[model samples]
Target: MKKSLPKYFRRFLLACAILLALFGLSRLYFRLTDDFRLSNITYKMPYRQAWEVPEMSEAQRENFNEILNQKFYYVGKGAQSYAFKSEDDKYILKFFKFKHLKPSFFVDLLPSVGAFKIYKEKQVERKNRLLNSVFDGYRLAYAIHGDETGLIYIHLNKSHELNKVVTVHDKIGLVRHIDLDEVPFILQEKAKTTRTVMTELMNNQDISMVQKRIKQIFDLYLLEYSKGIYDRDHGVMHNTGFVGDKPIHLDVGKLTEDDRIKSKEFYKPDLLRIVSKFNIWFKANYPQDYPTLKAFMDEQMQLIFEDERV
Candidate 1:
């Protein structure tokens, strides 16, 4: 009887091992067969352009060039602005200019900057991991590189077109000219258009259509927020037509370690801010759209706070 007991125990252990192996193999098969290619998505790189530095004297330009030459990239100027591109085609660079930096400022900002970089790296890893974990139907933006530097150069001529250049920057916070054009319309025009179109529809007593449209917008915002792919501000910007459809949370340069966790205090103010903007826009341009807007807000609140339980 004791010998038979040993035999049974060994069989049970063997069965458990087989089951575990099969489960792992199934997981691997699913991952391999998944249609989404998270690894292959290409982020938009800033294009390089030449900027005329009429403001700087020739001596200053020579000095600036000497300083910039130490780095591998060259600064170029274009029709309206300047940009930095790598000389060796290794990386795209953007320059952040500061007038004067005090010791206190550096002391305060350095830690935050380091934390932001770490958080950004973690977020990028999380994005890649989540792409394989579930079919959430959302893609998170990845930041390839970012840094702070005092001076940036722009070329004197438009030898390379916008798309081929390695680095580009705009005062409006766009990486490209196309994004610049789309951003203003997204931030200012789309929201107004949506409100106007909905209001006109509502005024004609098309309550059903108004509800449907509002719900659609609210759902999009909720989905964007849930994925952690966008902030509430950009969500509003995107919803209202302030920015392009592309997610804009890549400035993880400002992200804190606490931001990774679910914090109501952190997210609530931004959410309310967006709602306020929507309210102001609707009230000013289309008072008749208020009812639908309110319904949409309520739906967003429920979706954000209740349904997702975020």
Candidate 2:
């Protein structure tokens, strides 16, 4: 029974309450209509088997088909794509995620004039550009570095082999049926990230093993550079991983081909970019071992830099 709030303050509070209610309702409307909107957004790209690897045996192809036949469980999502694990857990199917794929109330309310129209058109253009780039990257990665990148196939268009409705258990355990032929996706062999492996080794206090693994990672980068293939965003911890004893780049979206990368001008900067994050993490968590590893890495990198080809 305390004194009542001022009339202006009460009105402001009421206005806020009304705004919150409206916001919640709008969210509910979008959530309920998302699937319908997504269905109407069609993505069609040409089907091309431009390159094939003879090294990929018939058995491997058969195994890949078998995995596709089974149900997939959603794993996790990254900025670029949504990952779903095969039933056997040996492979992953990644579906590209697009921005601004659905109509928005606010955007529709605009009169479609001047800068607003330009902004809308640019957004659509960007979405298409991103989709094409990722598709090409997968194709290039398979052709140039399939084994290292673990890319088995790119299904960019509808195919009879993948023509069927399939079950998928999503991240929150919700079950949904997905039509494979209607969706474009990339199939890749799943592997543990470098950071995961390094953390384990560090926990075991196996400094020698950690050093060995880091050397392999460095060697992998050098090989890519020698081949004129470069990963522009080379975050070793997240983008590179271990497939058996070999280190491979997991994220192929940013890879590009340029012989200029092998030049002296690009060598040290590229190497430093790749190792920067790893160095920070090591220094923070394993300070006692950081100096030794840093010295070893520097020696190894220097040798690579001095190579005649480089």
Candidate achieving the largest TM-score: 2
- For model 2 the TM-score comes to 0.79
Where in model 1 is the C-alpha error above 4 Å?
1-207, 232-258, 261-265, 307-310
Steric clashes per prediction: 20, 0
lDDT of 2 by residue, 1-310 (tens): 7999999999999999999999999888656433222243235445556522344467876766677788888777676677888888888887766433333446556666899988777765676566666666776787889898888876666666545565677665667777766776678888889999999999999989999998888888888887887887767898988877878889898788889878757756897777777789899988999998888877776687676432
lDDT score for residue 137 of model 2: 74
Task: Give the Cα error of residue 276 in candidate 2, in Å.
Answer: 2.2
- Every candidate's lDDT: 0.38, 0.74
Residue 7, model 1, lDDT: 79
Q: Which stretches of candidate 2 lie over 4 Å from their true place?
A: 1-61, 100-112, 307-310
